[model samples]
Target: MNAEKPPGSKQALVIIGMHRSGTSATTGALRCLGVDLGNRLYKGHEGINDKGYFEHSDLADANDEALSALGSSWDDILLRQENWWKREELIPFAARIRSHIRKDFANSSIWAVKDPRVCRLLPWWLEIFDSERISPRFIFVIRSPHAVFRSLERRDGFSMEKSFLLWSLHYLEAEQWSRNFPRAFVDFDRFIEHPAQELARVEETLGISFPISVENAAPCLNQFLSRDLRHHQERESPESSPVLSLTHALHQSLLGAVDSGQPDSLEMDALWNKMESIQSGFPRALVEHIRSSGSIQGNLQITMNRLMRSWSWYTGKPVRFLERLAGRNV
Candidate 1:
């Protein structure tokens, strides 16, 4: 397969999915398939993801800051506030994002950026893309809610109930926003079991080819995509909670669409609406406020630091005068 880009075609691959959903594995596979993952990557943390997380650190930090500015966090479920992206406040951050792209991927024709936060902050990135006149192809990775929850429990100490809710929120937002772009959804379970077939599907769906043969990339892939890494095995036909059932249905639907190469917009909408209805009573406003408090605390700290410094400068003369008086007495 030819890995070279067609003449004058500037494209990017943006991997959008929930955390612990095999996003890192998918990004690593893409890298093996000739996709440039930029220079500065997040080395996977020990005891969590020993295989390096193929995410850009700066981009991930920027996304966290952006979410903080919006009074949200990475774990926030109600982050998709309407028209938040169009706010004037995001302009500066957008400029920074553009700078990051230019700095990290200066010479590459086709590169990728993967941060689970991107699933929520997609509109902001889409605006940057539109203004910069760059087109992005998206690779959305999905996994069973049960497996994802199990992983989150082990990694983040999250409860299964909260994990299920977060899983639903992330995938729903990802599906809703990514519909307008060129995208392909990959099943993580299938991918781990059959890397070549899944990678080939990604290539055909996105109209790109790997730079090297699959045989060559096999060793690299094996290092990361192993059975031990897949610690959470999904139970066969196990009983699911209501939230899990809903998310599982959504997962199956997306997988079916991917296999058929056609997305069922109506079905997706119906499932999303069902989820929204069920979660209508959640304390979204309160949660948003609580999440935003982090940003407030951050800003308050900065202000307090400056105030202390200023007070020290102004009181320096008075303190020195007292010191001279005490010296004379002594």
Candidate 2:
């Protein structure tokens, strides 16, 4: 796999992160910098992210279908297959994305692709980018797991533990898979606090330029990253459990890399290995805990159904078991 860019290939700014971790805001900033997003987009609404997603809905839907083909969706982090990217089902979706890149952005010098699903789908996308001959520079958005959980809690009604676990698993895979790419981590909290400082650093690292400086794009940035756009900020810093400790460790390491303008993989590699070894037990434990009480079960059943449908593929459990578990108290 020659990862080098082809002579006439375009530059692709691949914006990735777990859902609600500010990928939207970061991509919106890219738009403010004169990067072409796409013709069709899923515009943000009053209740959701009013700043707009800056994402291609067709591509997002393709990602969802591809994940479903693999028995996992964006939120079903634990249920994804080991080495899933190599599966035959992803080829069609990869072709779709690659074709979009070739046709949609053919004239573009650089364009941005913003989708949380891209974090998990990087292996397929890396190959796609290579095949398309486009050079991809990644921006991994980071946010406090607790704060993200609060956002998910209000919006999706996800349990705190599930959200934290998703944060750990999602980024662990994203960082590991994107290790070889030209990439930079951006702390969304701080990025919103001071866009100019963070983006200046990001531009310096990627050898890519955003047409307008963050300072120059002040009015656009202000409108996109409004005070209300940032809804949650986790103040408590205690690591209450081994898993939370690991989550915090990943969060800190990402921010530390941002702080120092250096990317480190050794620590993240260890965290990924740990998460993999223990995650099979994690789903069972979380499910049993959710089932232990009848009240929480009712509150979580719909969300659990949405996430659990395809998880059976990963745990070697029958699909019926998860179906029953999701449908009933036991």
Q: lDDT of all the models against the reference?
A: 0.75, 0.75
* lDDT of prediction 1: 0.75
- Which candidate ranks first by TM-score, i.e. highest? 1
Q: What is the lDDT of residue 218 in candidate 2?
A: 77
Q: Return the clash pairs for model 1, or none.
A: 71-292
Judge candidate 2 at residue 5 and give its lDDT: 40
Local accuracy of candidate 1 as per-residue lDDT tens digits, 13-113: 88977888888888988788678888777676666778788988667767766776777677765535568887777677778889998887767768899
Candidate 1 vs. true structure, TM-score? 0.81
Quote the lDDT for 105 in model 1: 76
Displacement of the residue 106 alpha carbon in candidate 1, Å: 2.8
Q: Count the backbone clashes (under 3 Å) in each candidate.
A: 1, 0
